[model samples]
Target: MTDVIIVGAGPVGLLLAGDLAQTGVDVTLLERRDGAISNLSRAFGVHARSLEQLDARGLADPLLPTGSAVGRLRLFQTVEVDLGALPSRFPYLLITPQYNVERLLLERARAAGVAIVHNAEVNGVDQDADGVTVHTTGGSHRAAYVVGTDGHRSAVRQALGLPFPGRSVLKSIMLADVKVAEEPAELLAVNGVGDAFAFMAPFGDGYYRIFAWDRDNPVPDDQPLELDELRQVVTRALGSDYGMHDPRWLSRFHSDERQAPEYRVGRVFLAGDAAHVHSPAGGQGMNTGLQDAANLSWKLAAVLRGAPDALLDTYQAERHPVGRSVLRSSGAIIRAAMIESAVGQALRGFAVRRALSVPKIRARITGQLSGIGYTYPAHRGEHALVGTRAADVALAGGERLYEALRDRRFVLIGDADLPGWEDRVRVAAPAEAGGPLILVRPDGYVGWAGRDGTGLPEALTRLAGAPSAHMAGHTAS
Candidate 1:
């Protein structure tokens, strides 16, 4: 039996598998499709917060080199959100295809020795107190835990009999990847007018992706996409098609804003589109799912090692609010961009430009879109820093803060050494800078902080679960 069975091999599943396997958990990844990976991508924007998560695992180095950085995000013809001014190492959006991100994660997963099975469709799942048994086309597999990272039409979710309650927001949204003669001046370009809306972004290759929608053209998903029709919509929105030709791929799909009521069902849990899906307006769909994987992976690992089952509840507690917020924010963006009346369009543009012109409003919008503004509910009676992301601060001896987190272990950053936690936690002293002793969780969040080691032992036991039996008697420094 495997330690965990993860359904779907998308970015979320791959990241979770890689993280778990890296720490010696036996992870089995199941995919319905064959081994081949599609070249086309539906997502292109890699925001700052997602970059920070990737950077923590040392995977951002190769990905950053493959994508172009765009400092500005044009929401409408005249309204833009400036990402260059955000307070992060990766202040700009990286315009790379979804395949690029998946490829890197798949590579990491394979490197970490994750067992991957292709062309295996999961039909159903049943769980008891001992473990979960996943029913797939090939055979049955048992595991202590299971996660559903499948897409919107999730078989795992269906087997669990959970309702994905939501409505379709937009229909007949067209997408295509092709070569263009004249590229836009900005790295990321978007424009909307009257009844049509369109956006374009390069795939770091000669090919560019065209996302066009015409509210007046209500066609079925099966309607064949003609190059002329695509050009017509582009012209209606942007005045020109930039000489689009040689379509490599084209498809039409709809958007929906749906979320599962519960993220966990006994030993089975859900993440990514399986749990929630929102409009692609803010390009938050894939990023939100990836962060979910990051937040849940460490907790699952801890539970498998020895943590109490209650620790697992925090995953849903922390991520459900973020999911709701994304749904609202992204839905608003799509609604604003889809306004049909001339008066409504003018009002949206004016309101957006006027609101973003202020320094505080601009900063808040930037932070929200970039993913740095999100914070989990604080632990009971804890410091302000608790449950907040630990900023990547530079230490004294040429060691960066995130670099210390690559080992996937909690680090106690301070001057004093705690021998009792030597096996579970690494005690390191700050170089020149002096501050309160901080306990950073495996996921890079501050679990505890104080001037002295008061309540430090109890915090560790609560957050990280009790340490090994040998260290139980030893007192904390």
Candidate 2:
């Protein structure tokens, strides 16, 4: 049996498979479509935290040049969240097509020796106490664990009979990829009027993505899209469509704010759209999924490699709340942007403008949107740095914190001792005073921190699984 089977070869599944494969886990990835990268990308913004995950895998540099960066998020005509002021190395959002992210992750997954089977649609899943059986179009595949990243209409989720309790928040949202006669005022141009909303971003390939919706023009998803209608919606919202023409593709879909009741059921798990979905207002969909993969891959690897099975439970504990938070935030932004009444629009505009005017409020919004402000509950008792995102701090030997995490092993920065656990942990230079002796997880979150390595072994056992046989030790700071 394969160690793990991942359904859906999108960003989330690819990232998880790549990470696991990189760490020598046997992983198989399945996708329904023929193994061709699609030009159609529903997601655009790559948030800072997700970028950090890419950076940890040494992918950030190669992907950064593929798209432009945008530092501000416009809530409406007047309110803008300035991401440039946010903390961390990547203070702004990267506006790249979802295809760029998918391509990069697929490359990494292949390089890591993950067996990817395309055109294999997953029809059902059955899991017993021991393992999982995935029913696909090709055949039945067995694995110790199965993960479903198969999108919002997840067959695996349905097979498990899990409840995805939520409703469609927005409908008939029009999308198109086309060439424009002229550029917009900003790299990322978005605005909404009382009856319509529109957003535009470029793929850096001489084409622009146009998203527009008319509140008054409710149409069926299968209704053929007319360029004139798209032009009218964009013009109504942004005052111009930049002479949009020569459409490459056009479609309409609805956005829902739903989440699976539980992220896990027995040996089968859900991540990305398979677990939760929300409005695309904040561009949080793909980023959230990528982060979910990052959060779950490490725990899954540990558990499969002889760690206590209880460690896998933390994946849902830490990520479910983040998914809920994203739903609330993105739903609020979309509802606010879609306000129709004149008075309601004015009130929302005033409220958002006033809220974003405060420095702290702006920073908070930036942090939330950028995914840097997220914190998991401290498994280790309260330390100032516990459950916090470990910054890419400079350490001795000209190395950086994130650089130390590249190998997917736990790093003991400024450690004291881990006699038999050297195989699973790396000892590095001490962090700054406030963050001395920090234990950074493979996913880049601070698992533990203190002035010394006291209580470190317990945390290690809980996180990295029981350490392997003694290898070698490095001098502690």
Find the 10 residues in a row with the least total lDDT in model 1. 468-477
Candidate of highest lDDT: 2
State the lDDT of candidate 2 residue by residue for 292-378, as single tens digits.
999999999888878889989889899999999999999888888888888898899899889888888877777888899898997
- The residue-by-residue lDDT of candidate 1 on 1-477, one tens digit each, is 999999999999999999999888999999998977777658889899888888888888889988988888887787878898887888988888888999999999999999999988999899999999999999999999999999999999999999999999888889998788898777676887858888888977799898889898979988989889999999888888989999989989888999999999899999999999988878888899898998899889888877789889988998989899999998988888888888898899999999999999888888778888788898577788888878887776788777787777788888655555565677766665568888898777888998778888777776666766544343334
Per-residue error for 317 in candidate 2, Å, reads 0.7
Q: Candidate 1 at residue 164, lDDT?
A: 97
> What is the lDDT, from 0 to 100, of the residue 6 in candidate 1?
97
Question: Which stretches of candidate 2 lie above 4 Å from their native place?
Answer: 431-435, 470-477
Error of 2 at 292 (Å): 0.2
Clashes of each: 0, 0
TM-score of each model, in listed order: 0.96, 0.97
The C-alpha stretches of model 1 lying farther than 4 A from their native spots are 472-477
